[model samples]
Every structure is written in C-alpha cells, then in structure tokens.
Target: MTGRAHRDSEADRIWQMLVGLVWETRGEWRRKVSEATALPFSRVRILWRLVDEPKTLTQLAVSTSDAPATTVAVNDLEDRGLVERHPHPDNRRAKLVSLTPAGRRLIESARRTVRDDAPPAVQQLSKTDLAHLRRILERISSSER
Candidate 1:
C-alpha cells in the first residue's frame, strides 16, 4: 500500500479501538447504575438529564432522542413517585417534569455507583498514565467543537 493509504488504515484502526473502548465503558457504567438503582438504563438517563432543572415532555423527548419512549418512561417514573409534573408557567398546555425527593435520592445513588465503578483497566492506570490519557481525550473532545 502507498504511504498515505497505510496511514489512513492505521488511523481508522485506532479510531475504531477508541470508539470500542468508550462504548464498552459506557455499557458497563449503565449496567452498574441500573443494578444500583433498580431501574432501567433509560429511566436512569432521563433522571440524570433532569438533574439541572425541570423540562417539558417535548424537551425530554428531544434530549432522549425518542419521543414515544420518553413518554412511556416518564409515565412509569411518575407512577413510581420518582417524578412530578407541574403546569408550565409560560405555556398553559405544557407541563414541566421535575424529580421528586425519591428521584433525587435514587439518582444520587446511581451517580455514586458510576463514580465507584470505574473500569478495572482505568483504575489500574498509573497517575502519570491517567494524566496523559485525560489530556489526549480532552484534546480529541475539543477538536469536535
């Protein structure tokens, strides 16, 4: 292969490896959070999204990227006393969804699960190696913006 073609192939391989690593870590984190919270990953995600402030159902749907699924998840969360809806001040037709005290406690537990369950490989990294990895990852993240 030409030098350019060889470089491109190597870059593709590295990109795939990085993507795989990220996905694996994400899946593991989700699993741990689900186990700790006794809720599906989807519900956990919605809870995390609502952490900052209340959101309309439409807003949640947009953020979650699945309107129908968001509706169903919100219904379930509401039924379980994890969330409550209050009339939106600006739009009489819309209601804003916010976490209840129970929801806050559960999400806090999930967050702790995430913090305490770092992947073993990452946990094993030396401080210097971790710093290098963080810098490289931050550079990659900033390049997209």
Candidate 2:
C-alpha cells in the first residue's frame, strides 16, 4: 500500500477500536449503575443525564433517541419520586425534568459503584494516560458539535 493508504487504514482501525471501547465501557457503566441503584438500565441512563442538569421531556427524548421510551421511563421515574416534571417557563406544552434529592443521591451512589467496580486494568491506568485520554476525547467531542 502507498503511504497515504497505509495511514488511512491505520486510522480506520484506531477509530473502530475507539468506538468499540466506548460502547463497551458505556454498557459496563450502565450495568453497574443498574445493579447499584436498583433501577432499570434505561431509567438509570435518564437519571445520569439529568444529574448534570434539568432537561425538557422533548430534549430528553431527542437525546435518548426514542420519544415513547423516554416518556415511559420519565413517567416511571416521576412515580418513584426520583424525578419531578414541572411546567416549562417558555413552552406550555413542554415539561422540564429534574432529579430529586433522592435521585441525586442514587446517581452519586451509582457513579461510585461503577468506579469501584472498574476492572484491574482500567483502575491501573496512570494519571498521565487518563488525562491525555480525556483531552483527546474532549477534542473529539467538541469537534462533533
């Protein structure tokens, strides 16, 4: 192969590996969160997003990629007292979802559980490697916007 072709192939391999790792890591974290919080994986994911900030049901649905699923999960969470749905200020038809104090605590516990459950290899990553990986991921994430 030419130099350019070789470089392209190597880049493709790296990109594929990175995507696989991201998906696998996300699954691992989700499972750990579910086990720790006693909540379904889907609900835990919604809570994970909301722990950062409040979002409208429309926004959550868009982010989660399934309006019906998001609506059902949010309704279930609301009934469990883990989330509150309030009227959006600007949009009368929209409702904003926020985590309750109990929800926050559960999310915190889930996060800690996931961290503690990390495998030996992940736990053994050096600080420098972790920081460099974070920087690379941040760059990729921002470029996607």
Candidate 3:
C-alpha cells in the first residue's frame, strides 16, 4: 500500500479502537448509574443536562436529539416528583423544567456511583499513564471545536 493509504488504514484502526472503548465504558457507566439511581439511562441523561439550569422542553429535546422521547421522559420525571415545570419568564407559552430537591439528591448519588465505579481497566492505570492519556484525550477533544 502507498504511504497515504497505510496512514489512513492505521488511523481507521485507532479510531475504531477508541470508539469501541468509549462505547464499552459508556455502557458500563450507564448500567451502574441506572442501578444506583433506580432510573433509566435516558432519565439520568436528562437529569444530568438539567443540573446546570432549567431548560424548556424544546431545549431538552434539542439536547437529547429526540423531541418525542424527551417529552415522554420529562413527563415521567415530572410525575415522579424528580422534576418540575415552571412558567418560562420570557415565553408565556413555554415551561422550563428544573430538577427538584429529590432529583438533585439522585443526581448526586449517580455522580458518586459513576466516580467510584470506573471500569477495571481504567482503574488500573498508573497515575503517570493516566496523565498521559488525559493529555492525549484532551488534545483530541479540543480539536473538535
């Protein structure tokens, strides 16, 4: 193979490995969070997004990338007293969703669960190795923007 083709093939292999690792770690994290919080991964995702501030259903839909699913999840969260809707100050027709105290507590617990439950392979990384990995990952992430 030509040099360019070889480089592309190597890049593809690295990309695939990175993607696989991410998906596996994400799945494990999701499972742990769900078990810890007794909530579905989707609901947990919405709660995490709301941790910063209140948002309209439309905003949540956009962030979640599924308007219909976001609406249903919000309804469920509201019914469970984990979230509440308030009138949007700027738009009379819109309501802003915010996490309730219960929701906040659950989210805190979820955060702890995730923090304490790093996958075995990650947990085994030495500090020096982890720092190097962090730098590489940060560079990759920064390139996206």
Candidate 4:
C-alpha cells in the first residue's frame, strides 16, 4: 500500500499477480519436467486428458485446444510406444486415443512432484478459500457460449 493512486483496483492487481504467478509456476513445472522426464509437455497433456476416458483424435485436439500439430504430437507419442491409437469403437474411420502402460507410467512419475513436494503448500491455504477459488476458476474457464 502506497500513496500512489493506481488506476487499477485491488482485484485487478490480484488478477494480474495470479497470471504472473501462473507463468512462474508453469515455468518451474516445465523445467522440472524437462530435467526429470522424457515426455514433452504436449504429449503429457494428451496423456493426462485421456486419464479420465478415451477420446478420438478430433476430440482430443478440440478439448485440448491443440491445433493441427495434435496429429504430430500424438503420432510422436505413438511412435515412441507411449500411446496407442486404434480405430474408434463406434466409428471405424475415427481413432480413439488412450494411454499405453508406458504413457501411464510417465504421468505417474510426473505426479510424484505434486504429491511429495506440494502437500504443504496446499495445506497453507484454507479449505474454503481453495474450494471457492477452484469454483471461480472453473466457472471462468467454461466456454463463453
């Protein structure tokens, strides 16, 4: 708090701070991943997306907001034997994406950082604040339509 009259309100400042924090957080995450893991960020995201359920390449690309390179990423993973793309159960032409044993193992290793290193950070936040923040962020992330 200073005498300077910032045109922005406290909420705006907090929002911008959170954005910068996100960049810092992701940067750190990327560095650790690059150092400790062989998978690329895009490959990891595709694998994580399928953790819930299988999806076609089209669905994965749209859901992940990945562009044309989705094929390249998925293909790379497939070539590495990390993921297997096969004909969609319902649609012959479309291909479904899922994790192979290798893919799941890779994501499992990534989770070690969060589980082993971040529980204390999570404990510092009040449960109510964490819940409220999650709700707000989820609502904001929904499609505008």
Candidate 5:
C-alpha cells in the first residue's frame, strides 16, 4: 500500500470533523457578530433558500432537510420581522416566505460574519493546500446531493 492511507479509511473521521466544524464555525460567527444565541443556523439555511426566491413553509422544510419544526421557526422569524410571508398567487392555501429588507441586510451581515471567524491556523495553509482542501471537500459532498 506504500504506507498511503486510503480515502475511505478517513470517512468516519471526516464525517465527525465536518459536523464539528459546522458547529464551531457557526458558534464563533454568532459570538463575533450577534448577541442572539438562538440564531439556530437553521434560520440562515432557510434564508439562503429564500435568497433567490420565496417558498412556503412546507417547501422550506423539504429544502431544509424536512426539518421537524420549520413552521414554528418561520413563524418566529416572521414575528421578529426577519422574514415576510406573502400570499401565494397560485395557491391560496400556501404562503411564500421571503427575506425582509431587514432580512436581506442580516444575511449580508452573515456573509461577512463567517469570514470573521475563520481560524488563524487556516491562514497558515499553503494556497495550494487550501484550494485542494476545499476542492476535495466539495467533491466528496456533491455525492450527497
């Protein structure tokens, strides 16, 4: 085997590390940007889905991994003025969720938020190593979608 580790051998380690990074990245960004601890990371995801086009809560659930409480969360954001619900033109039974003007502003802020929390050790990575890391990660994840 020439002492090289096979890619599959790292699968479990990679999965654990990936989920851990998601929390670390989100927690750090939240601390650096907003005082609100309920940001949920789920809300950012829902907002991202609505960034281009509005969707109903059910659709948002489907898009957001069929989250169990998407309805409750959407209602909470609507109450906070972060999201606006508009009447669905084609389906009266459904409502479309869109980011408010304020929501747009919040997500714009989050874009910058993520960069602010990136670890300094990551800065030590060579440009090629960094690019390879990103490419490998994305390539591996594309199969999940």
Candidate 6:
C-alpha cells in the first residue's frame, strides 16, 4: 500500500475502535440504570430526560434516537401512570409530557445507579478533560443537525 493510503486506513480503524469503546461504555452504564429502575433502557432514557420538567413529544423525539417509537413508549408510560400528558399551554394541538412522582423517584434511583456505576475511564477524567469532551460532543451533535 502507498504510505499515505495506509496511514489513512490506520486512522480510520483507530477512530472506529474509539467509537466502539464509547458505545460499549454507554451501553454498560445504561444497563445498570435499567436494572435499577426495572425499566427498559429506552424508558429509562425517557424518564431521565423528564426528570427536570415537562417537555413536548417533539422534544423527546429529538432527544432520543428512536423517534419513531417515542409515541408508543409515551403511551405505555402514560398507561403505567409513570408519566402524564397535558395539553401544551401555547400549542393547543401539542402535548407536554412529564414524569409523575413515582417516575421521578424511579429515575432518581436509576440516576444514582448510573452514577455509581460510571465507567472508570469516564469517572476518572479530570474536570478540564470532561469539559473538553462535552464541548467536542456538542460540536459533533450540532454539526449532525
């Protein structure tokens, strides 16, 4: 192989490895949260996002990768009484969804599980490194949209 082409291939392989590692770490952390909450990973994700306040279904869809399935998930959560849907104040056609008290408690417990089980590499990052990582991730996400 030509030197430059070989170097490019190597770089691509290394990038893929890094991406895989990050995904594995996230999956592991999410599994722990799911177990602690007795909720599927997807539901736990929704609950985590709703911990603070109500959000529109569109917002939830945007926050989660499984946008198509969000409606069904919301319906299930509502059925279980872990979440509630209220009419949006400004948009009559839209619904604002939020966690119920039980949902909040369950999510809080899951959050604790995730925090306690954070990947060592992530937990050990220096504050500056963490900030840098966050900035980089934000830039990447923004560029995708």
Per-residue lDDT tens digits for candidate 4, residues 1-145, read 5545554577689889877766655766766765556766767778889887878888888977666788898889899888898788788899888889988888788877533243345558898988997898788789554
Q: Which has the better lDDT: candidate 3, or candidate 6?
A: 3
Model 1 pairs in collision: none
| Model 5: residue 132 alpha-carbon error in angstroms | 1.6
Candidate order by lDDT, decreasing, is: 3, 1, 2, 6, 5, 4
Per-residue CA lDDT of candidate 2, range 47-134, in tens? 9889878999888988786899899999999999999988888889988899999889988877666774555566699999889978
TM-score winner, 1 or 2: 2
Global lDDT of model 5: 0.77
| TM-score between model 1 and native | 0.73
Candidate 5 lDDT by residue in tens digits, 1-145: 3334666567768888878877766666656444342477777677778888888888999877655689878888888888999899999998889999888888887776556645766778899999999999799789888
Q: What is the C-alpha RMSD of each candidate to the true structure, in Å?
A: 3.4, 3.0, 2.9, 5.5, 4.3, 4.2
* Colliding pairs, model 3: none
What residue pairs clash in candidate 4, if any at all?
Answer: none
Q: lDDT (CA) for every model shown?
A: 0.90, 0.86, 0.91, 0.77, 0.77, 0.85
Please give each candidate's TM-score: 0.73, 0.78, 0.76, 0.69, 0.68, 0.70
Task: Identify the runs in model 1 with alpha carbons over 4 angstroms from their true place.
Answer: 1-12, 26-28, 91-93, 113-115, 140-145
Tens-place lDDT digits, model 3, residues 1-145? 9999999999899999988877877876778889999899999999999999999999999888688999999999999999999999999999999999999999997787676456688889999999998999899899987
Q: Over the full model, what C-alpha lDDT does candidate 4 score relative to the true structure?
A: 0.77
Q: What clash count goes with each model?
A: 0, 0, 0, 0, 0, 0
Off by over 4 Å in 3: 1-9, 91-93, 113-116
**Ten-residue stretch with the least lDDT total in model 1:** 110-119
Residue-level lDDT for 120 in candidate 3:
80
